[model samples]
Target: MAPTAKPLRLLAHDADDLAVLSAALQDAVAKIGDIRWDAQARTLTMACNRFRWEAAKGKSGERVRSALQFGDVAGVQARNLRRDAKGAVVELLSMGFEPAEEAPAGVVTLTFAGGGDMRVSVDCLDVALADVSEPWTTPRTPGHAD
Candidate 1:
């Protein structure tokens, strides 16, 4: 019998923790419209269909709906991304944090496959990732040339 997997939930309070979240989110895809920022709440969130790299084994794979969120966001900026193209999809490559000279305050960059990026400037490192639904079968796993 195949091994069973459980729902994943993670909280990132610092750079080291964020690295784990980044790995879990690698190859995740999201629609432009699914990404949202609420200025009043100082939060940024994205609903993503994330490749289940952690649970994946052998030839078969799948993706799970997940929510990635950042709190205490001071501002958000995008580069090489078209917010107007709501239907467009972006594949997440990786994520990293650049510390601000002021200490806990810093920028969290979400790098996409097609040279697109979204930077969230935050008051501190505060992020969460959680699988929101059951995984669905995927015939092909994501591949990279490198």
Candidate 2:
């Protein structure tokens, strides 16, 4: 029998923590599964397939469905948030936090490869990553720019 993948849950507390989370999420490819915001809860959640990073010997490429949640969210501004984005492949390029003028929290931006961006204004940096499935291989070869 194949070994079952263990679910992962990661939290971010500050800018540094966010950076770590960002690194883990880098190069992740996914179709925007769900975009949800709760006014009362002050949270924004986006679900997607996150390329799994592993250190297992001989393992090449892998990916797993995952959800990323942002808490203390004051608001969410997104470009190209549509049904078409539901199944279209998107890659997370980078993530950054911009300090707010008055609010203790700041804006966290998630930029994708195809110009799709989601900015979350939060009371504080609160991010969570949870894996939803077992990883499967997607072989890749290293490339070098000349």
Candidate 3:
């Protein structure tokens, strides 16, 4: 049988607020990083500052947009946000995942958000949120071990 993998547990904390995570907030704070995966829990984990962002009203009044910026005024609009009024729609755009816009709820979600986009790992040691297919391989004989 294949070895069973354990789930990843992370922590997301806003240095500024240290409370709730809102799009209005994430857009304001600059740095973001957290531990992603570990055979066991980590000690002295390393994190990097993430892109600084700013939020502005989008084309639609209900929707808010975020842009990634550095140093000077931010110019790149990254993602769009609004409440989930209709059925769920998850989209992959340039900045990050869209529609799943609401900051992860609960301490667990906060931790998971710290993990960032599961599609691409923020850190090398991070594990996938889903099953990763093993790379294709050709059968080998035990003799090949030599």
Clashing pairs for model 2 are: none
Q: Which ten residues in a row have the lowest lDDT in candidate 1?
A: 1-10
Q: Kindly indicate the candidate among 1 and 3 with the higher TM-score.
A: 1
Cα TM-score of candidate 3: 0.18
Ranking by TM-score: 1, 2, 3
Best by TM-score: 1
Across residues 1-146, which tens digit of lDDT does each residue of candidate 1 receive?
13486878999999999999999999999999999999999999999999999778777898999999999999999999999999999999999999999989999999999899999999999999998998988987888987
Candidate 1 overall lDDT versus native: 0.94
Residue by residue across 1-146, what tens digits does model 2's lDDT show? 13655666889888888887787787776666576788898888877766656523353656677888898888888786554556676778778988788656899998877678988889888799888777766676222236
- TM-score of model number 1: 0.96
**Model 1, 9: alpha-carbon shift in Å?**
0.7
Encode model 3's per-residue lDDT on 24-77: one tens digit a residue.
223221222222233233222213221112212233111112222111111111
Task: Show how many residue pairs clash in every candidate, following the order shown.
Answer: 0, 0, 2
Enumerate residue pairs that collide in model 1: none
Model 1 regions lying over 4 Å from their true place: 1-3
Show where candidate 3 strays beyond 4 Å: 1-20, 24-35, 39-53, 60-107, 110-146
